[model samples]
Target: MCTEELATWRDVSLVLLAAEALLTGLPVALILGASLRRLSRLMVGMRTVLFQARMYVWRTGEVTRRAMGMVAAPFIQLQSTVHGLCRALDILGWR
Candidate 1:
């Protein structure tokens, strides 16, 4: 055999190992990339849930505005009633 022939079993094994790497490496790399993408999406969702949970723990619904809206409505209604009564009393000349 020529010296260029892979003369040793070690040389043949090395060539086979390289061929195996070339054949399978592309598929392994693709699988790893797909798994990384899925892991990234899962991490983002987990972060959002963690942030919302943190905000809730900080506020306990105290973040909601206290309602003072109803406080003035009843007084305005009382004033209107008094104005109507005064007008009726004047029309009758009863006061």
Candidate 2:
């Protein structure tokens, strides 16, 4: 009779523990699922914002590079002219 009562108590305790785990774990799982859903949505928006920022930076870099090349053109041309004149003078034995 004591052994039977012990078995019954053990079974009851197991059931209670199962119920407690279900009660706690289910809400935590649901909350985690909801948070993941919200995070995925936010990530979609962030992806688009990052892509736009990248395009803006690319365009700005392209414009700046073109402007720098334009600004340096006259100096490059003058240097080339001077080098050619020096070469010609050397070839003519006039240096």
- How many clashes would you count in candidate 1? 0
lDDT of each: 0.84, 0.97
Q: What are the models' TM-scores?
A: 0.40, 0.58
Residue-level lDDT tens digits of model 2 in 1-95: 99999999999999999999999999999999999999999999899899999999999999999998899988999999999999999999999
Over 1-95, each residue of candidate 1 has an lDDT whose tens digit, in order, gives 66657568669899999999988998999999999999999999899899999999768655443233366667878999999999999999999
C-alpha root-mean-square deviation, candidate 1: 12.7
Assess candidate 1 and give its lDDT: 0.84
Off by over 4 Å in 1: 7-13, 59-95
lDDT accuracy of residue 51 in candidate 1: 94
User: Which 10 successive residues of model 2 have the least lDDT summed?
Assistant: 65-74
- Candidate 1 minimal-lDDT segment of 10 residues: 61-70
